[model samples]
Target: MSVSHETRDGVAIVTLQNPPVNGLGLATRRGLVEALAHALADASVEAIVVTGGARAFSGGADIRELNRPESGMEPTLPTVIAAFENSSKPVVAAIEGLALGGGLELALGMHHRVAGSRAQIGLPEVKLGLLPGAGGTQRLPRAVGLETAVNMIISGAPVAAGKLAQSRLFDRVVDTDVVQAAIEVAKEAAASGELHKVRDWTVEHPEAAVFLASARTAVAAASAHYPAPLRCLDAIEAAVNLPFDQGIETERAAFADLIQTPESKALRHAFFSERAAGKIADVGADVAVREVKQVGVVGAGTMGAGISMNFLNAGIPVTLLETSQDALDRGLATIRRNYEGSAKKGKLTAEQVEQRMGLLTPTLEYADLKHADLIVEAVFEEYSVKESVFSQLDAVARPGAILASNTSTLDVDRIAAFTGRPQDVLGLHFFSPANVMKLLEVVRGKATAKDVLATVMALSKKIGKTAVVSGVCDGFIGNRMIEQYSRQAGFLLDEGALPQQIDRAMEAFGFAMGPFRMGDLAGNDIGWAIRKRRYVEKPHMTYSKTADLLCELGRYGQKTGAGWYDYRPGDRTAHPSQLVNELIERHSTDIGLVRRAISDGEIVERLVYALVNEGAQLLQEDIASKASDIDIVYLAGYGFPVWRGGPMFYADTVGLDKVVAAMRRYGKGHEGAAWEPAPLLLQLAEAGRTFNP
Candidate 1:
């Protein structure tokens, strides 16, 4: 049984026993109700103390069970809460760790609640694109004031139990033995015969009408793309204005509506996908991970310094190497500046700044890396540069030390080949500004050992990253797919759409930035170099020369203050350049192509479907293990909007058949081979299957 019952001194102690996190799934809910019935049946049991063992009181509803048919099974959260509220015997909630979402609602249903001071408590359904369904909206407002309750419901961030002790949300905030305190409270309640129900209290504000109206306006403006926040505000308004029971019905009805929205579905998909991204099908739990204690980072450039910060923040000592003393000094200064900036922002203390900086050892010689358990080379993106670095690392590094390359787009196998031990080499592709970005693509080379892959994957979590394993391929999973997307963006430029138009359409579709804006921010010269290489590597690959012409004029993006858009000094804003527009027209004319107006809808579909089609190809080639893995990569790394899920999930929402049809239409206008739907997409479309399913 998920729940257990034991009576002590006329008080029935009902314990939720679900491990890890006590998710109130169907069995747990039913068990809770059954335990309650048993306690009420005995006249000797005058009161009940509900506790969720030593771990979490309850983390909330079982997210894995969400949307399943069994989720609505009898003794649902509402039914369970109703039992607690109506129980003849006083029910006291004993919260030890976390009481969140439905868990908090369960606590609110009880007559009394006693929590450990350190316990976390909240109704955080808004994060899952939901509002609380089981009387939380009504009762929370009654316990805490309308403003506090609304803020808690909207933000979905947990507050420590100690923070809410004065809010009447908790009957007692104890430093020790929460269940014992709850038992005492329940015993006292049983003796007093006074029923304290949150439902009986009135939700009041001095100027409730004014506050609620202002709140509704604010939420509507902030949550234009999301429907849940506005719905949450509406629920809170109902809590303040309507009767207790009517407010509950209002909240439930709103929840039922929001749960079915595409926004909610996307958020839920993102949540599950991130969790699934960490598990490798082939790498079992028993796979031994190499201990990564001392780490070495080569190249004291922007990428190198950021990579070093991740290890330092995790309390691992780092030996940062650069070819020149000046370079090494510059890198160390940047690292210190970054930490000092954090300290200034109140995110870190002065001692923490010094402590993290103290972990970094700047060196000019490669010999210092001999003791590193893992060495990540963040040198320039050149085959020759990488070859020299790896050859030297192979000679100087200790046996069994993992040699990793932080190459965004290069052959990991080729880098590994430079070293005698190919099994010890792999790619740890950290996105630019590595310390800030969460995605770490663990590129597994052909000869990479299982243990090495396991070690890197394990280390990824230690440093707080959502690691996705990728097979060695040109650009790996994210960039290879992004290349196609960028190609489509360039094609759109040739087809008569301006940069800002494409950006606005994509922003509307939920990309944080359009391709042009992103290119500008990341330095357009990077893509120029990649294209130059691609031109020699694959001569037949068609690409728009508009970008090359812009580069020819030295408009290399934000660093140069000009590219597809003009920028003033110190301002990153992209103002439309008439010169660039004329240049694009000239390029189109020179290529013997006529410019025509393009719709925003076409722009969104082409760019997004480009990612989806390439993602399907990656899945087919097994470069990516699963479709959701690709989604996680984009969601965590590429600024793909979380509310749209990822490209694959969005494709599923659009229906594979429709996506294929759109690709066919785009194929007629653009390069036909480039737009040819992937075989997997065609097969899935034919069978009416989704990538996720």
Candidate 2:
């Protein structure tokens, strides 16, 4: 049983037995109801005290059970709460570690709640695109004041019980044992003979209407399109206007409808996919991991400096190596400037910044990295540049040191082959502005050791990164899929679509920036270099010449202050460039291509479906172990819309059959070979299956 019953003195103690933040599944709910019934029937029982161990009161509903039919079976969370409400004996909640989502709602139902001062409490269902489906929306405001409950429910962030010690939600917030404190509260409640039902509590506010109106504007402005924040406010407002029963009905109705929304499904998928990305298919937790006490970074440019910040912030010392004293000084200065910028914003203290900066050892010598545990090469993104760096590391690095290449496109296996210890060499492909970004693509090479992979994965989490493992391949996962997306964006530009039109469509569809604006920000020279290589390696492939023309004109992006769009110095805003648009028209004419009016729908489909098709192919090739892994990469690294999920999940929601039809329709146009659906995508569509399911 997930619920255990025992009697201390004349009080019946009910403990939630499910381990690791006792989730309220069907069995747990059933056990709770049965225990309440048992306590009510007992002749000597004076009061009932409910508790989940010291680690957690409850984390909430068993997320694994959320999709199951049994989740809504007979003894639902509401039914168990009803049992407590109907009970003659006083029911008290002993909250220890955390009470979140349904867990907080459960605590709210008890006649009295006794919590440890350090316990975390909140209703965080909004993060899953939900309002608390139980009675949280109604009771929270009545238990705590209106503003506090509204803030907690809407933000979905935890608050310490100690902070809420003055709130009525907890009868006593103590430093001592919470269960024992609850027993005493239970005895007091039993003697008082008062049914302290939250439903009877008044949700009072002097300026209710004005407060709700202001909140609506704030939430709407915060997320212009997301429905949850506003929907949550709607439910909370119901608690203020209507009775508890009506408010609960409103919350339940909102939850039911929200679960069916595409936004909610996408949010739920993202939540699960991120957690799943940490686990490698073959490498178990039992795998041995190397200690990474000291880190060595080659190259002292923007990337090397950012990479060094991640380790220094994690309290690991780093030896930042550059070719010259001048370059090393510049890199060190850049790191300090970033830290100072953070301090100016009050995100870091001056002393804290110095503590992080102190961990760094800037050097011009490769021999200085001999004793380091891991050496990450963040030098220039060229084979020869990496080859020289790795050769020096192979010669100078200790016997057990792990060597990593921060190569975004270059093959990890070939990079590993340059070193004598192939097992210790792998690609740690960190996105640009490495410390700021959450995604870390861990590329596994042909001969990379299992322990080496495990160690890097662990270290990635320690440094606050979502690590997704990728098999050795050109561009690994994100870059490979993005290449196709970029190609489609170019094709759109050639077919009478302006850079602004294409970028606006993508941005409207949830991408952080349109391909053109992104190119301008990331530097147009980067794509030109890739296209330059593609011209020799993939001569048969078709690509728009407009981008090449833009780069050739010395418009290398923000660095040059011009590319697809013009930029003014000291302002990051991109202004439409007539020079670039005229160039696009000339290129289309030079290619003898007729410009057709392209719909925003067509632009979005072409760009996004291109990514979906390539991702499916990667899944088929085993370059990616799972579809969810690919989704994680895009969601984390790329600014794929969270509301739409990743491209793969979005495809499933759109219906694969429809996606294939769209691709087939696009195939009739230029570069038809690239638009052909992957065999795996076609197979799944025919079988009526989904990529993530």
Candidate 3:
């Protein structure tokens, strides 16, 4: 790592050159200090401008070096910010691409910030289970005020230079070259010869203290198991209440404290794990992915319309095939309404909506899709319909044209085998409301060609979705885990815990929505449909008897105004129904099992252990590549909070031995239920090792 200083017409340029992200590691930090010394000592250099070569300004402090004992040499970011602040000349920042985490913190230190048109700025330390360690807490509050700062820091969202300028986060936004803009700003400042000091900028609306307090409460409520967001609030509060130096000290202390936490370590592990997810061991980067300029969709229901929208929204033309003109019209109307609603909500302009709408072409014939580079079948769950659709798609679509299915639970290999071109067939399992959900489980069939896998994975990213590759299995990664997790929730209900108690415990565990609440929102009938099919295959095995009973009574969740709880028409909030409680009591009594009072800890353990146990099974079977992949699936597709890391990461934090013990206890107490500890969980418990390691 090195930082070079160059002077031209009273403007000093400081370039941070650390390969890759240019993270503020030991060498980079020391080099930065030396560069600042050169700029500040020069008599002719009136202003200093800093920028990074290549794309990223910096990702963050080098994770590989952060906690290394030998690197006591790691220059704490606060010290470097102090140097930037005490400089005689106004410090300007010229950011090209991404300025994230500590990168954004360093930018906050400068007196003036100018970025290129596409430059994005964000403090994403929260994603790593941390807050900005440098004086970002103090300075950003001074720049964008309290509320905006809190939202950005908590959400870990980055915005373009234009938005940043509108929000006044930057002193100026430049469309031309950033380095040139910085030089001009420096020269203009030198001509004026005005004393420019960031510290002297008084914070307006001192009542921002109230805003900080409210934000703290919201953070605490949002982050129960995760410590970073709440810790971030403490630093922001210090900025509001304490002196600049004291606030800096407080921010450093809080940052140091969080870096040592297990939550942070797990989250940091997850961060690197996700980047590694796309890189398969056998597949090299040279694997040729077929170009997919146009796509074709079969079926015309909600799933097909949503699938078409995803392709169209990504600026890819889609040819939608249906059996009749009526079905095509219905599908087209749904697509139109979806885009029109988005336009009305300001997510898209009317003209932009029309442009996107024009990308869709509906046809009642399969021959029209002959030119499509990729074709996806999004028909009903019935294997016959899917098989027939794939057969037709194989005949019509050109050779080497990738064939895919949006089947959630169907066997991908079976679907692949239905068509003559098995190597070209794969499963692109998009979640319901495909265009909205972030996760798309790209199921690799036994005969799925490498090129086909590569193309779908790339396409998934192009459409703004995180795709996790999985082997052909019953439910892939997310649903496979959900099957066990939801089963445990149902078991808890039979064993004595109410839906409210289960939901509460899970919420406390950092899930955005619990199983019962999720069931209510998704309509419990979906599980009923799948469960009926599953029960047919496993006739002898014992399963939860209460869920079907609830459905039998016409409680199909929020849709019918009744399910786990009674709904008030359009309202989302849940209230327990006496009828459901009576049903639970009757079921418990019919089974001759005592419905004893269950503790909150028991509710949490049973539910979480069920999922963790399944994740272990997935790991053992190689359905999930790593322990963190399961976490990513849950974090993105499910409502698993990022701060707690994910279910598997949380399990490691809770300890494997404890999970094994709970599983054993629950299995013993609830006879005939599927609450057994997974073999991998038992093995790890015996060895006393964490899943993440």
Candidate 4:
């Protein structure tokens, strides 16, 4: 049974028993209803207390059941809540840990609520591009007034029980043994013969008409790309204007509409994809993870310092190594500056700044990292530099210590070959500004042990990273797919679209920044250097010379205040450059090509489909375990819009058939070979299947 029923001295206790967070799945809902019925029918039981154990009351609805037929199963959350409302026996909710989304809605159905002070409460379905569908919208305003309910629902952030205690949501706030206190409350309420229902309460807003009108305007502006937030406002407005039952009906109708929207579908896909990314195909729960108590970092450059901060923030001590005292001092200063900045912004306490800095041991010797549990080399991205560091680590490091390379694009297997114990060597490729970005590509070398991969994957969570396992490949998952995306962006520049036009189109499609703007911010010289290497290695690979020309003219990017677009000193905004525009026009004329008008639709399709095609290729090669894993890599790491899901999910939504057809059309263009659809994409398209399916 998902719920257990017991009684003591005429007080019945019903406990929700789902592990983790007691999600309101079909079985759990059925169990709750059955338990409630049993309590009401029992002769010995006069009052009832419904509680979830120390972990959670219920986190909400089961995400796995979303959009599935089983979501509409009998004894739905609304039906179960109605049963609570109509019960003869007083039902008091004893909430601990969390009561969120449908979980809080369930608690609101009870006659009274008593919560542990530490318990968190909210209706947070908006994060999943949804409103609280199970009467949360209609009932929350009645419990916590209109404005507070609107802010909570729209933001999808939780409030602590202690904070909401005076809001009348909970009848009593207890610091200890919430269930026992709730049982006492239930017994008293039963004796009083009075049941308090949230539905019987009226939502009072003095300036209802003016406030809701202003709120609708604010919501529309803040949620321009999303439909759910606007719908959420409408539901809240109904709560203020209509009667209780009418407001509930309006909320249900709005929720049903938002659930079917494309934006909601994409958001839901991202939600599940993040959870799915953590599971390894071969690694079992029983796999032993190496203890990463102490971390050592080589090369105290920008990447090294950022990488070291992740461990330090997690309260792990770090030993930072550099070639010279000056380099070590500079790196340490940068780390301190970063922490101080966070402290200034109220993100960290001043004591936390010193605490993290105190953990760092900066040195110029390789011997200091010998006893380290895990050593990460964030040296230059050159083979010789990586070889020297790994060889030195192999000589001095303890036998079982894990050796990790923070190389974004180097061959992990080749780097592992430098160490004596290949089983302990792997890649921990962190994205730029490592402490901020959540994506960590855990690249698995051929000889890498299951425990090592499992350890890093598990450790990623400790460091607050979303780790995606990748097989040994040229660029791993994110950078490899991004190479194609960048190539297409370059091709678009050479064709007809200018830098700003391309960036604007992509931004309109919901990307935080367009390719040209992103390239400028990331330093265009970085890609120029990568291309210089590729020019020698893969001579047949085609690319636009526009970026190279920009680099030739000493426009390296924001560091130089110029690249595809110009930047003023101290401002990161990209302003249109007449020199860059003339450079692009001159390049087009020099190449004997006529620049034609390119539609924004064509630009968006080409750029996004480029990623989709490359992702399908990665799937074909088995570099990525699943399609959703690729989505997680892009969504978390590459600034792929969460509202569009990952490239794979977006492609599926666009229909694989349409994507393949677009690819075939693009294949006939100038750089035709690059646009040729991946075999997997073609196969899926022919079979009328989706990448996610």
lDDT of 2 at 280: 86
List the pairs of residues colliding in candidate 1: none
lDDT tens digits, residue span 505-594, model 1? 999888889999999899888899999999999998878888888889998889999988999999999999999989988888888879
When sorted by TM-score, best at the front, the candidate numbers are 4, 1, 2, 3
lDDT of 1 at 390: 98
At residue 423, give the lDDT of candidate 1. 96
Candidate 4 residue-wise lDDT, 1-693, digit = tens = 899999988998899999889999999999999998898889999999999999998998897898888799888899999999888989999999999999999999888999999899998888888898878888888888888898899999998989887887889999979988998899899999998999889887899889888988898888887888888888888888889888899889998888888889999888888888888888989999989899999989999999999999999999999999999999999999999998999999999899999999998999999889999999989999999999999999998899999988889999999988999999999998887999999999999999998899889999999999998898999898889988998888778889999999999988888999889888888899899999999999989999899999989889999888888999988999999999888888888788989999999999999999989999999999999999999888888888898899999998999998888899898788998889999999999998886
What do the candidate models score in CA lDDT, each in turn? 0.92, 0.91, 0.83, 0.91
How far in Å is the alpha carbon of 663 misplaced in model 3? 1.4
Model 1: residues with Cα > 4 Å off, grouped in runs: none
Scanning candidate 3 in windows of ten residues, the lowest lDDT window is 195-204
Point out the worst 10-residue segment of candidate 1 by lDDT: 667-676
lDDT of 1 at 312: 99
The parts of candidate 3 lying over 4 Å away from their true place are 1-12, 18-21, 34-48, 53-56, 63-65, 69-72, 83-91, 143-155, 159-172, 187-197, 206-230, 261-270, 568-575
In candidate 3, list every pair of residues with a backbone clash: none
Q: Candidate 2 on 224-319: residue-level lDDT in tens? A: 757888899999999999988888899989988888788888899999999898888889999999999999999889999999999999999999
lDDT for position 566 in model 1: 97
**lDDT-better candidate, 3 vs 4:** 4
Candidate maximizing TM-score: 4
